[model samples]
Target: MNNIILSIIFFLMLSTIVFLIKSKKNISKLFLSILIFVGVLIGAGLLYLILMIFDNDTNISDTIKTMIPLIASMVAAASVVIATYNTVNGEKSSKNKTILEFIDITRDILEKGEITEKTTEILEQINSKLKSTDFKVDVLVNNGAREFFEFLNAVEGKEKIYILDRLEKCFYYEPGSPLDDLKKELIRKLKSNNIKDMRKLWVNINQLAGTPAKNYNILYEECSYSLTNQFIEKDLVNSKFYTDSLLKNDRKIVDGLLRKHFELKYEDIPIQYYEVYRVCNNILESNYEQIGHFFRTVHRTLKTINSYYERNSLEYREHIGMLRAQIPNQVALLMFYNAVYSEKGRGMARELLASNFFGDRDDFHFENNELLRSEHFLNNGRFLNNQDAHIAYELFTYNKESNKVYNELEKMEKKVVPVDDSETKLKEEIFTHYLFNKEKILLDKFIKEFHTVPRKFDEYKIFMNPKNNKK
Candidate 1:
């Protein structure tokens, strides 16, 4: 009877403490919970002692037997409370540590003047201290590369281009220069499928070669083509180097890749041209309003498409050829619209669009093709009759006014020599000489070099205040 009463008291005490702890809200509920369990066990032991005193026939063995369960419950509660506290504190500490580490790294990089040396030291420190975490390993490597290149550029000027050229001629280039040994080493690593090690070597070579230039494309092709092909094991249509080249806007690399990939066979499908075209079309379709870059790429693609059509070898002859003719101009207009609202690029945007529209291609202008006309050619709209004022406004800003200013100014600058056999011969000879000179010799370059792009009266008038008429 005494034992039963004690169990009831124990249960009530536990319930009351839990409710109190929960309601108070500021107490350490974990510790309170542990204390409640201990209090309940003590109550049970008091009840066992009371029963022994009341009965007098119950011995010490009976008292111990009753106390055993209470002792166990107290120990279990204490263990759980200690474990919960440790876990909560440990997690909080770990989260704080991670945040501090990232902040430290960002601050160190942002503060350093000699970023390359700093980054190199950072890598060594991470290896020695951070124990090489995968979460930021690649990011660290890429950051280090950027820092190193920026440092090199600051010190070397444009002569870094020549240094890279010479380096290429030394290490995996130049016959009998131990390149054979490196080849053997690479083959062994590749056979082992040591992708991590192979990537490291490629990274080292790229750093040693320095910043990407026209010549880097040639060296990358020579070094990685066969190996990358074997690594991919699927008739590699595009090299990793080519993808990197794309990100850098190195058109020279792009052109070389197109030529190389065009000849490779893939599972009864010639995939290179098609793949390149598809990626381009995806870029065009998705990001039409932001295609400042699509102009040059589209121009190259169209030239290739024309070549294919002329040979009658193009698989998607009609569609690709039509797209090639049309998409570049559309991209140009969209880019112009995106730029015009901005203060910085407005004039350049207008000038670029006008030049592209009026530049050569007499053939495309006269052709009565609806696709070409709708996509590229400019047309006047009847605003008053159709009440199409918005369309008229768009046409005015995009074409008529801009083109008029561009053409008038362009013609004003030129000394329009009358068409003569002697003058044409002189021009032809000048162009030939310019072509052989290996320097920029275009009309744009000539204008910039000489500071001679003539300004038209209309463009000049926009900025000037009109003279007041006498009343």
Candidate 2:
């Protein structure tokens, strides 16, 4: 009889405590539950003992023994049921916390055009936790699918571009994610003639080399929408986008085609037509020393681009001429950045420059080492003070005058430039030539000679902004 009473008390106490801990219920409630169990157990025990003591029948002990077993079984079953219920509720609560946290992060991305490193760390933690369990991983993916569609319909302009880029990148770690579908859906929208700035779209699409998202057929179909034109020929090298896409294909055919083209050049196709193409060859095939030499001498390449710009009017309507005008500073800008910043593989960033158009590519590729360094370099964040290196070539290319380039560089070196007095004449004389070349050797030298240096991720929003692809 005593053992029966002790067993009932033990079950009640154990089950209540287990439920309280598992459910993470309030401590006060746990205490109250314990008190209730103990009071009931004591009362039941005392009553049973009293009944046994008063019994006078010869079969009383046997009857009491049977009653004790039946009561204990009922009590054990009830305690187990309570514990199971609490444990289930606890699991649901944990899942709810993950869902809410994911939603909050999605909202942050939508509102700020950025996310902090702390938030990224939190998301990583959540991702780790979710992967560690079978619960709620599908829930996040389902929610992501919903969010992806909603973003497709409602978002637009630069912000939409940014958000979509982040969406694909943020959930890249997720299995069976809808990002692949989301990209394909957006590409369909682009091809279906439902969106604006299709020209810009082609440029952005070409920048997607070295990515898992490379779907060349979708790109060709989209290109036919806006790019099948007088400026375009049925030939393989029709537009910069076509050339960039071709370079994206890695095969002996491209290499053989490159060899043949180099062997025989028809001058009708301007050097501008073949220069970037040739650079692409060097980019994909060059040895380390050869690449170093090319960067070291790239100022000469910039000069050739400047020469092309001088012969054509910036107002030229032919897409070829317009592309010609855009390529010079585009080359300088990308090459300078690829050389200076040590983020993405130099090869990756270099290849991206092949598809470069009017500098908006920076906004889309916010994470590239090149873009990251440019961000801080322009803002004078840590490495450089003269942002003129960022835009000096733009003015130089536009005006076809070395003086315009000289002026920006001169402005940057104010301690040396514009001093007409006799004391600084020699200093001005030396700095004069450095500031005013058709192709400034100084910038090229900076790129070629610059060794990969360490940078802090926290210094710019680029690193903390998540590994997003807004660039």
Q: Encode model 1's per-residue lDDT on 1-471: one tens digit a residue.
A: 544654575556546554654463444656666675667567666856666576545555565566567556555655554466567657745644543444344334334534333333432332232122221233233333343344335544343354344334433534554544444443343233343544444344333332343354433422332222222322212233323432244334234333333242322221121222233244334443433333334333433333332222333234243342443342334333223222232333333432322232332332222212333334232101111112112322334544554455444435334446868988776655543331211223322312221211111110111222122
Task: Put down candidate 2 lDDT per residue, 399-420, tens digits, no spaces.
Answer: 3343343344435555445555
Question: How good is model 1 by TM-score?
Answer: 0.22
What clash count goes with each model?
A: 0, 5
Which stretches of candidate 2 lie above 4 Å from their native place? 1-57, 114-471
Superposed on all Cα atoms, the candidates' RMSDs to the truth, in angstroms, are: 32.2, 32.5
Whole-structure CA lDDT of model 2: 0.37
Runs of candidate 1 exceeding 4 Å displacement:
5-41, 44-52, 59-64, 111-471
Superposed by TM-score, candidate 1 places the C-alpha of residue 137 at a distance from the truth, in angstroms, of 42
